[model samples]
Target: MEVKGKVVVVIGAGKSGMAAAQFLASHGSRVYLNDIKTRENLEERSLHNLEKMGITLLLGAHGDIAGLQPDLVIVSPGVPLTIPPVAEARERNIPVWSEMELASRFTKAPMVVVTGTNGKTTTTALIGQIMEDAGFKTFVGGNIGVPFISEAEQLQPQDVAILEASSFQLETTESFKPFISLILNITPDHIDWHGSLEGYIKAKAKIFARQDEKDWLILNGDDRETRALAGLAKAKVLFFSRKHILEEGICVENGYLVVKLEGKTVPVIKPEEIFIKGSHNLENALAAVGAGWLMGVSAESLERSLRTFPGVPHRLEPVLNIDGVRYINDSKGTNPDASIKALEAYPDPIILIAGGKSKGSDFTSFAEMIKDRVKALVLVGQAAGEIEEAVKKTGYYNYYRVETFKDAVYKARDLANQGDIVLLSPACASFDMFRSYEHRGEVFKELVHELAKND
Candidate 1:
């Protein structure tokens, strides 16, 4: 488990890969970094970090992964193990791992690990805030843009860290266990990376893979995928659900959010008290409350945080209300299920903006929900024609296909009338038109602002 001063070869010179290489080198390890691109094609800034650590670089695809004789192979989440060199390394019994796993082995701090197909960011951020409010020194990072090794050695057991774990990281980790593990829900996500729905679910289950019988493992009891796999957990089982009440967990009943713990009914807050206005977010709060319960945080603090937390952007973010038609940016709805949830949260007739890079998700089920709820559908990005076809297949004809987020927004605005909602809930990836879902959401917001100014 001791990775320090060992021979470490980090595959893929991406953000997490560079962070891992630099951190390993700083700990006296001779690091070897590799990337798919040639040296000249590499961005100068990333290479500079490795240079500062004095690590050796191997550019282009040709790598002696098996020849390095490295003690550990740090595989970036973006790198597939099926890559010939990496597979060859594994064949030689060279241990492979994620940066998160390698970084965690060096830390003694207690952690709150959060993983899901979605809501990982919001739930992790909420857990971090709750831990901080409980007077614990908190480190918030993992899959959410921060590497674990960067801060692991500096942490104490008194410190509480929240990690947003991804399936890619979970699949490679051997010792990436945590004191409190939260599996929000398992929906079909990252199928491209995981290769199948079953593979993805098994990856998410690894969040509890390393925990002991005493550790706290939180889950979503309502999700069939998560609930069906609960028996695989070694740790104590705790859950968040909307279906039924538990002696110890969070739930919704009679339109109220209740915390049932140790024969006590504690009301952290009601469903309506939550600032986040979607069904998925309500489930996210339940997961956060479950994390808080284990941290010994008072229900009062959980209630305050739930009501005060404004919510993360690109997940049903409301931009402006123009002429009684509210515009919502839900670019984070990168799957059919996620977009279906967003559509379900609305009561008013919706002028929906949907489409992006399809992840092999069937938008058919969502069309049923959209058909009844949507006033008009403005499609764009890679999946526009497919989504339009999907909507039509549902026997619903109110749809349009346009290019660009701005054009989509304008078309939605024109189609939207008083008391209607304009929603940018693309049920696909953003690679076709934007750098990311955040970029898509930002463009949606900017265009909404422009329209507001004109009105």
Candidate 2:
């Protein structure tokens, strides 16, 4: 786990790659950063951040395995294992790990890691907020932004680190056990990288691989996929359920978020008190409550945190209520199940914007939610036609489709009545249009503002 004075080769040069290189170099490792981006593009703000960290840049080029004998090679979540240098690294028997793994090994700090196909952002933010309110110095990032290892040396043991761990980051991790770890739920996602549903599940289960009996593992009792993997964790398993009521697991009992353990019913908080909405949000809240309880956060603090917490952006985030028309930016809905949850969050007639880079979700089920709530479909990005075709095959036709995000919003403005909800819940990835989901969501917000100003 030690990287001191080691020659480390960092791959990808994206957000994670840059952070890993800097984190390794800061700890006295000589880090070489590699990316396929052109020298001109490498001058962007993202890579520029790494230059000051003293990493040797290998931009406009691949990581040359022959030139540098690296003690460690770090790969980003988005990087493929099939990439030439990565394959070469494997052939050389060079140790490869993720930014999260490297960070965990260096930090003496205790962490509460949240990983799930959905709700990771909300749960991670919620845990950090609760711990921070309880007077813990909190470092809240990982897959969210700025890996904890990048700042762990500056943080004390009394400080808490809450990470939004992703399946990709967990894939290459070694010895990255959290003090408290929770897998919220697993649904079919990232089929593009994983190549199958089973592969994706395998990647997510890696989060619990490094835990010990003394450590605690929380799981989604509601998700069968997550529940099936609970037996593998060396840590004690605690669950939060929206499906089955348990004698000990977190459940909605008597309108309270109840955590019953050892015949004692403790009220962690209330579901309605949470700022977020829908059954999914309820599950997300309960999961956070369970994590909070495991971390020794008192019920009172959790209740207060629930009322005070502002939910994470782009997951059913209400942007504006213009003339009684509520527009929600759920650009975080990068998969079909996530979009379905966003749709269920509101009953208002939805002018649904639902398309992007399709992530192999069977969009046929979208008809059930769309038929009941959607007034019109405003589609964008590469998967627009595919989403529209699914609407047709599901017998919910007559939905409109627009090509660009701006056009989608404009048509939604026309189709939406004063009481309607215009929601951008693309059930696919955002790479076809925007840099990231956040970028796509920001554009949606800006266009909404522009429309309002003209009105």
Candidate 3:
């Protein structure tokens, strides 16, 4: 933990890496910030600012780690350990730590870590809000938006660090333990990045890897993959399910978010009172409520926070209504399971705008899953042909293929009838044609607003 004057190499000058560099430099560490992209591709102002802080920027290539003889190497979530520089550093016995790991060494606050394929953002944000409303100083970040390193040094003992941990972030983490850990649900995602489903699951399981019996692990009882992970955790296990009442943990019983702990049943809140829509969101609510209860947050505070959290944008946010047609932007549905849940949220006939950069997901069943609910399907991005093939197998002919976001949005609008919903729930990542899912959702909203102007 003594970082002063120690040489450290930080990889990938993205948000996490940049924050890690800034933090290390502030702590008096000699930090070399590296990114794969050349200096020409980067903003000169940002690099100059880092240079002013005594942090060196090594752009275009991961420069000479062995030559630098650094005391430690810090990696961003986007860069895998399999990369030559990181792998070489490992062989040389230099400690290669993730931003999460380094930040945890400085953070004095008790952490609440949330991980899952679908609901991590919603659950993490809700838990952070619940704690804040209960009058605790809370820092919410990790995979959601802000980097944990950015706020680690300022965290107080009484503060709560709520992190939305992802598989990528968890991969390089070693000693990043949390007071409470919640795994919302595990489904196959990031297959290309992880190389396999099992690899992805192993990375996510690391969220509870360093915990002892004193810590708590909240899991999804309904998901076989998440439920199966209970046996691996040394921490106390609690479950949240939507299907059946559990002997312990939280579940939906007669439309209320109820908890059964120590053989006593307690009602948290009615599902109707939860501001977020869908059964998937109900599952998220149960997880947050259970975590809050464990932290001794009053039931009243939990209910109030759940009813007013206002949901994370791009995760099934309704943008604008053109005439009677409703447009929903679920751009956060970056995998098949998430999109499947988005489809389940609507009862009205849907004109779904889907497909993006493929995540090696099997869209074979995607079309079948939405055959009854989706009136028309508009495909975009790299996976359009793959999705078209899947739709053909379902014998659903009302599908269109478009090349860009503009085409997809207009096509969906044209296909949607009065009282119908046009959902932008791409069952893939946004990297093919857009920068991020937020960018894709913004474009969809802009197009929808244009339609409104025309009306």
- lDDT tens per residue, model 2, 1-455: 67788999888877777777877877788888888887687657766666777777888878465469887889988888778888888788887888888888767788899998999999899888888887788899998967666787777777778999888888888788888888998888888888899989988888888889989899998889999988888999998898777888889888788888778898866677777778998888888888888888888988888888889888888898888888899999999889989888887788898888988777877767787778888788788888888888767875877767788899889988888998999999999989899999999999999888888
> Which stretches of model 3 miss by more than 4 angstroms?
none
- Where does the lowest 10-residue lDDT sum fall in candidate 1? 60-69
* Model 1 CA lDDT for position 69: 82
* Residues 269-362, model 3: lDDT tens digits: 8999899989999988899998899888988888899889899999999898888999999999999899999999989999999999999998
- Backbone clash count, each prediction separately: 0, 0, 0
- The parts of candidate 1 lying over 4 Å away from their true place are 38-43, 253-256, 453-455
What order do candidates take by lDDT, descending? 3, 1, 2
Sliding window of 10 residues with minimal summed lDDT for model 3 = 364-373
Better-scoring candidate (lDDT), 2 or 3: 3
lDDT of 1 by residue, 1-455 (tens): 66666888899877788889888888888899988888888788778767877899989884677777888898987688888877887888888999998878788898899998778888888888888877889899887757887888899887877899888889898877898898888877778877999999988888888899879898898888888877988898888996787667789865678878778777778888888777888899999998888888998888888878888788888899899999998898999888888898888899999999998877788888888888888888888888888889889998888877778888888898899999989999998988788888898899999999998
| RMSD (Å) of each candidate, 1 decimal | 2.0, 1.6, 1.2
Q: Tell me the lDDT of model 3 at 205.
A: 96
Per-candidate TM vs. native?
Answer: 0.94, 0.96, 0.98
Between 1 and 3, whose TM-score is larger?
3
